[model samples]
Target: MTITVFTNARLLDLQGGTLTAPSAVLVEGDRISGIGATDGFPEGAKVIDLAGKTLMPGLIDCHFHVVAYSLDLWANAIAPDSLAGLRAAKVMSGLLDAGFTTIRDLGGADLGLVRGVEEGLIDGPDLVICGKGLSMTGGHTDLRQRTDVRPRCPWLAPRQHGRSG
Candidate 1:
């Protein structure tokens, strides 16, 4: 197993509501095996001194719209599918940089994005997606305006009747 030892770091204990003094964290492969002083760590283990920086657990976002790239519904609806996916990728990277390790997306994120994370194609958090957004005929997820009479988006396939417009 690949071992990494992180030393000289202040560990944050959320449950106990305390910040520990300089400590050592031992990681084996992808999992954290232990947290304490560096003694007894295996030889040849890679070591990184944190220089008195704080190390805390990654955060979680329970409510995130991965495809809602913009606040304006119309703008998001009009954006191309590829463009929206690209924008979501950027959002994911930003969230990861901010220490978010997991995100639950309520809408618009597809299986592709989820797979992207699992396969390490995307540098982002673990994603829990709903496949697609659901909405009532005229509920919050409905992007239609009262005065508008066009289909929701152009990239979408034709309706059941094969009507393109």
Candidate 2:
């Protein structure tokens, strides 16, 4: 496995509410193998110096709408599926950069996005999704503006068997 060592980091312990002294974290492939002083680094492991930076656990967002690219509901509703997927990818990448490693998308995200994340096609956090949210005809999931009277987006509405209500 590819082994990497991160040194000179102050490990943050949120539960204990403390920061450790300068330490080294050993990572083997995708998993953390060890954490302690520099003496435990495996031979030939690639080393990264944190330079006293804090190494903390990744954060989690319990609720998110990954497919809603913007606050403009009408715009989102009108966006093509390909465009929306691309936008979601960008948002997911930003979340990862901001140290959020896990996110639960309560609405709008689909199985395709989940597969993309799992297969590393998208640079994103571990996404937990419920496919889509339930709403009444004039309720929250309806993205139509008050003045514009258009049929609800078929993709946004939950399907029942072979039909959409």
Candidate 3:
């Protein structure tokens, strides 16, 4: 297996709240085979100089809505499914690039996006999708204005709106 070494870096050890001095990390293939002050591991191993930078694990967002492309709920709710999926792909890639390695989607995401991420069709956060959220007219997910007519959205089904009676 191929090996790579990262040197001249400070390693963060959260177990004891410590920072190592100029440590080295040895990576074999896609996984880190060794860590902390490593040297002379193997011949022809690629070396990366961190220049005293800190290396840490990626972050995770516990809650997100990948399918909601617009702040205006009506805009997103009315968009075609294909269009919404495309927009989600872009947003998910940005989330991955921003170091969100894991995310839990609260609503408006399905297995299709999960499959895309797994197959590498799009670079994105590891999704823990909760499927579609239950919404009602005049509820949090409903975005209709006061002047809007009945049937806030066909997708959400306005008949499901809550009633005070």
Candidate 4:
């Protein structure tokens, strides 16, 4: 197995304190093999001289709204067409680029968006979506006013789901 080594780096161990001086890290393909002093490096391994750069694991955002911004939920819910989907894809890409490799979308996202991200149909972060958020009528997210803008009713807002109220 081929091993890639990164040396002369400072590491921030969140569980511990911080690592001072130059350190070394090893990676075998996608997984990290080991991490320690440069003396542990194997012969003929591809060595990267980090030159004292700080190294840490990829960041994760536990809560984020992938589909709609906080203030624009009404607009997004009203028109969740291709345009909205594209917007969501762009937002997800930005999040990933910002070092949030994993994100849990709190609300305003549907199964289709989640599937699109998972299937690599779009460039985006690894998404964990709640599909839709549950809310009470006129309690938190009442979208009765925006009905004229778009025909489809908000699926998550509390109301009569079946035949009766």
Highest TM-score model number: 1
For residues 41-127, could you state the per-residue lDDT of candidate 2 as single tens digits?
778999999999998779999999898898987788789999999999999999999999999999889999989999999999999
Runs with alpha carbons beyond 4 Å of true place in candidate 3: 13-19, 135-137, 146-165
How would you encode candidate 3's per-residue C-alpha lDDT over 28-89 as one tens digit per residue? 99898888765675799989999999877789999899998978877888899999999999
Ranking by TM-score: 1, 2, 3, 4
lDDT (10s digit) by residue, model 4, range 1-165: 778898998888767886767888898877898878787677788999998998777788887787674465678777747877888888988887777777888776678877887898977777777767667765446666534455445874567657863
Provide the lowest-lDDT 10-residue window in model 1.
Answer: 154-163
How many Å off is the CA of 94 in candidate 4? 1.2
Judging by TM-score, tell me the better candidate of 3 and 4: 3
Output the better candidate (2/3) by lDDT. Answer: 2
With a 3 Å backbone cut-off (N, CA, C), the pairs that clash in candidate 1 are none
lDDT of each: 0.87, 0.89, 0.87, 0.77
Candidate 1 local lDDT, 96-134, one digit each (tens): 999999999988888888888899888899999877778
Supply candidate 2's per-residue lDDT for 47. 96
Model 3, residue 8: displacement in angstroms? Answer: 1.9
- Model 3, residue 144: distance off in Å is 3.5
**Model 1 misses residue 65 by how many Å?**
0.8
How badly does each model clash, as a count of residue pairs? Answer: 0, 0, 0, 0
Give the C-alpha miss distance for residue 15 in model 2, angstroms. 4.6
In model 2, the number of clashes is: 0
